[model samples]
Target: MNIDISKEDFELAPGESVLIHTNEFIKVPNTLSACIYERYSVKSLGLMISPAHYMNPGYKGNIGLLAVNHSTVPIKLIPGIKICQLALFELTSEPLRPYEKQGGKYMDAKSASISKLHLDAEIQEFLKSKGVQKASDDMAKELGEYLMGHIRASAKRLADILRAEEESQKNG
Candidate 1:
């Protein structure tokens, strides 16, 4: 769906992130799933969407995008820009139970949702079996730290490359 990001245009300071809703609401069939991706052009602008790209079958909702600014300066997200795309794939076979039938927490979600993984019965059971009730929280913190560190390092490397290019041009 084509959407105008004009009114929704947002600025993200370096290292900052925000959740943005897609202009389109999607409905997936039980026999199909989708992978969400950021448009390649956006990468050149120093913005990235989280890599959690998988969309479950039987989902009906507006996609929520986690936008991050990795550049040293703030990045302005303009409306009307093709921020993301969806690649749909056919499943080998339909599941006996689809997400909607199973009471998926994110069913019909209109906006980006925080993780509801903790509410999954299997996850709860696994945590109970492992005696690690706080695992989810701990894992989230660790993952955030790891990702931020990498982003910082990548930004530094890009800056270094730019500086080198400038110097080479001056001498050439």
Candidate 2:
């Protein structure tokens, strides 16, 4: 890990997310993988939501995260919040090639964005095609609530699956 970064350099206001740059952005050597972990210490207990927690090998440039404080209390983000760590490992071969050649969804994410997921027109169209229409002005409020509830349940199911996998990996 021939890289350099510090917390003071990534200073943040009470509610802000800044791109913490690194000294060198290694290319993963085409034969290694990196695992990023968000180093947060709090009693989250499924109540607080952290930022994204994975960065694959072959990713370029300084890694940035779209972190936010989900708790009611204001949390100051010091530059060295230990936001994340990139664990490097030698891979048997290049992992699935570069993102561009793989044509994955995040192939075009040149930088970190704080945008909502599924807010793209392409996704909206897909949802509409699946019969999720915006109700009339009179029904808009109620319809929004209903949709939110459904989405929350779906997200809960996804979280459950992820938790189960993590637990199994720890035990087995």
Candidate 3:
């Protein structure tokens, strides 16, 4: 895909989505363009891949695939399964400037990168003006402590509930 999608060996619940990163990094030739589609196997399992638009010729990166779980239950992706395809189409003529040549934002990506929407030219100037400043040591510590307190409380509550449920079953 033009952008990066990253996921692996995940149990996707119904209405949940996953990002699929290709194991192999491929380099498309300048003379061809491609589109990514899921094979029939995925469809049979009630999974549908979001169709990626034309993989621009001369792209050099791991293909990203976004899949949605539509089945009633959770589904785990199995490895070594041919889940999708890159259907390459020959161009009438070679492109004067290809993906890598023009320094596309996604060129030579090594991992599943989320949408680089912030990097677009339109909003960059505004974003720069409101750019993030480094947090002070005390400020950082205070924020971290606050968040951690909530995390610990939530975790303890869940643990207590589970323990009670187990005890109830044993007593019954």
lDDT per residue (tens digit) for residues 1-172 in model 3: 2332234455778867766677778788999998878888888898888766467889988766677898999987776677787889999999999988876877777755555554556556665578744334455457656886898799889989999999999998
Better of 1 and 2 by lDDT: 1
**Candidate 3, TM-score vs. the true structure?**
0.66
lDDT of 2 by residue, 38-79 (tens): 555632521122354454565555554545554555554444
Candidates in order, TM-scores: namely 0.66, 0.42, 0.66
By lDDT, the candidates rank as 1, 3, 2
So what's the TM-score on candidate 2? 0.42
**Predictions in order: lDDT:** 0.80, 0.51, 0.74
Worst 10 residues of 2 by lDDT: 1-10
How many clashing residue pairs appear in each of the predictions shown?
A: 3, 2, 0
| Candidate 2 or 1, higher TM-score | 1
